[model samples]
Target: MTKSRPNILLIYTGGTIGMVKDFETGALKAFDFKNLLDRIPELKHLDCDIETFSFAEPIDSSNMNPKYWVEIAEIIESNYNLFDGFVVLHGSDTMSYTASALSFMLEHLAKPVVFTGSQLPIGDLRTDAKENLITSIHVASLQHFNEPVIKEVTLYFEYKLYRANRTTKINAEHFEAFASLNYPDLVTSGVHLKVNTDYLFKPNTKKRFKVNKNFDTNIALVKLYPGISEALLRAVFSTFGLKGVILESYGAGNCTTETWFLNILKEAILNGIQIINVTQCSGGSVLMGQYQSSELLLKLGIISGKDMTTEAAVCKLMYLLGQNVSSKVFKTIYETSLRGELT
Candidate 1:
């Protein structure tokens, strides 16, 4: 008997990585998925077989939403049994958001779904697309004893692989476009792929893989700053059909100690609105009650999103709200790390 080569699927969702410039006209166009292997002959050198899938109409990551997320999940679900792993090519602008959303949308994921993109077009002479795309596929195809080594959603950028939900896009021009401040890189691509096995998420093998397409987008994000007005806060909290809000506060989740501000938050929570407290800083966990300002928020039932990126918090709230989780235990569940989005 002979061992079968792993089949890795390249899902192109559209981004800088897929664009190619015509030498004659200089006009950029989407790269056809059928010619993927032709364009990148280096792929033939990999031990695994490769396949490609593209959206009927390519979408920029800026236009990405819940509908597209469900589409991606459906693609994975439809081909779940056939492919060994998946690599999603997305735009760097909102890669973190899409990656985070996918983390929640795909439940009990036991295969790698590595999201990656480059800062330049694939046809550019100085492009980073080839390296990012090639390495992502390799990472996806990694296995030990015929079992996938990474069994979770991940984001690979520059030379680091991070847990999808833990990542945030910190730069626009630099090839190092993402940062996983709260968590360590799962793998580092240098002279060799060094995988931090202990940091990788291990899913329960017994649980069946599930695709969660239900995501409530009726939520808002509010970033607190000095002298934020009570009227502005009132309008946001009172928005019609708003089920949740991601409150990005100062370090350690501290916020205004004003009576008016506290009153508005209390009223909103009392009205059954879910409020999640996330830190505004790029790194650090939210420790409610550590300070007087944040203590009231904890007492008022605001969920502490400890060490979670705003991207993760937003998607988690959407996923939880879509499940129709009862208000009674929403805070408890939100605070707990459901998909390893938080510490």
Candidate 2:
């Protein structure tokens, strides 16, 4: 008996990883993905049948939003049955955001959805795109007992594979551009691929796979700074149709205990604006009520975001708001880890 090769789909959403330099103009341009296999001949040697799909037009990651997030989810849903795994080539700028969004969007996802990109263009002499792309596909194709090994959305960069919702883009100029400070890396690539199987997500295979395309963008993310004024907080709460706010607070989700600041947040919670307290630090959990300052947040019924990155918290808020969960349980639901995003 012999094993069969996996069928991996390469989706080029947009990124510097798939660009080629135009020598005459000295500017990088998006290359024709139809020639993807030609540029990366090494892909032919992988034990998988590869197919490529490109968006009609590439988008810069800075402009990434919920609309594009829905588009990506639909693509995966439509092709779910045909492919064993998916590798999304996306810009590193918002790769963590997109990865986090998809983790919440896909329900009962039993196959790998790996996202990867490079800091430098593919045509660069010292490009990192080839390694990232090749390894991502290989990771997506891993199997055990004729079943997929990675059953969650993941972001692969430089040489590490992280749970998508646990990742944060920590650097803009380095090859090792992403980090999982509060969580462990799912996979690490070196001389041999070392998978931390204990940390992998396992989905309920009995349930049918479903795609969640609806995402409400009526959300605000505000960071707490010294001497922050009331007017700015008022402006955010006053935004028409604003449904949620992800408040990035100081260490352990603490903020100024001033009466004015507390009143504004209390008012928002009363007015049905879901306010979440996530820590500003990159490497810790939000432990509301652990200190006197954060005790006020716990008393105000502010939802704790725990260990989730700001990128993940933002997407999770939008996703949950779109689901229209009632205020009575919204706080409880957000505090729970729907996608292993928080502790």
Candidate 3:
């Protein structure tokens, strides 16, 4: 039997949630997390022992990258047995990417790992930080039959809990900073915290928590647009040494049937680079070959990212590439939903 007091590790990566107001000038700035408990007095009341570790110099969410993903994974890996759960405070900008990457990096996780951040500074009067921070910890510490309840990566925002990889930041200015258009909420908070058990992911208890820290971020996103020129297309496809491409195409994943564009994509795929076709519009799946333009992509062996958000597609590609998996096996893994990251 486990102790009633759950042990949670709070990883504070730079973001709005950790910011506070400068007492005299009233300027909102990142707070020193050394005094985190003093800042949030309510944490003491929870039935959990919380320990925090902040970055030496906090970085804005925009600067988040694959390196940081590996760092976070290492922290969890080193302290896996000590903590019952982990809650990460991150910026909303790249929170989905980090969450998604973590989902793949931390394999066979049998405890909750919830990522959350707020739109406003924590020290402000009407900041959304209070609720987001508190609720994330609550969700992290949740248990059933004396074991952790949620055993996967998750994002909690605006009173809703969603699978980490399935989420996308939809609103920048609003309190509801994210939405999982490809998937349903894992839990919703109202009169009582409701857990959608049917939609939740159950880990393979048979496998060990294998961490893949080597993620390759050598990827690009190409959104198809009308009147896209040959020079522009050629430059994008040839400019850098790209390992993968997330092609955000028109409805149903259609693109121009131009010979030049077709050849560029075919050459890339033949060179063993992955090209994932995802829909540009919300609430739809990418159906390759459903139209003439997209047929070119299908013929060239491009992979259909059916119902995957651009965020998920990009992060998943990076995660897969990090494993140094062969092109054939990479396709098999990308199209397969390993952690409920895709439909």
Best-fitting candidate, scored by lDDT: 1
Positional deviation of residue 71's Cα in model 3 after best superposition, in angstroms = 0.8
Listed per candidate, the RMSD to the true structure in angstroms reads 0.8, 1.0, 1.4
Model 2 C-alpha lDDT versus the unseen true structure: 0.93
Whole-model alpha-carbon lDDT for candidate 3: 0.88
Deviation (Å) of 149 in candidate 3: 0.9
User: Alpha-carbon error at 183 in model 3, in Å?
Assistant: 0.7
lDDT of 3 by residue, 1-343 (tens): 5566898999998998888889899787878777877989898888888899898888899999888998999999999999999999999999999999899889999999999999999988999999889889988998888888899999999999999988888898999889988788998977678999999889997888888888787888999889888888777778577889899999999998888888899888887789899999976898888888788888888888988888888888988888888986777778888888777
Per-candidate TM-scores read: 0.99, 0.98, 0.96
lDDT of 1 by residue, 262-289 (tens): 9999999888899999999999999999
Q: Model 2: per-residue lDDT, tens digit, 27-96?
A: 9999887887898899888889899899898898888888999889999999999999999999999999
Q: Residue 95 in candidate 2 has what lDDT?
A: 96
RMSD (Cα, Å) of candidate 3? 1.4
Residue pairs in collision within model 1: none
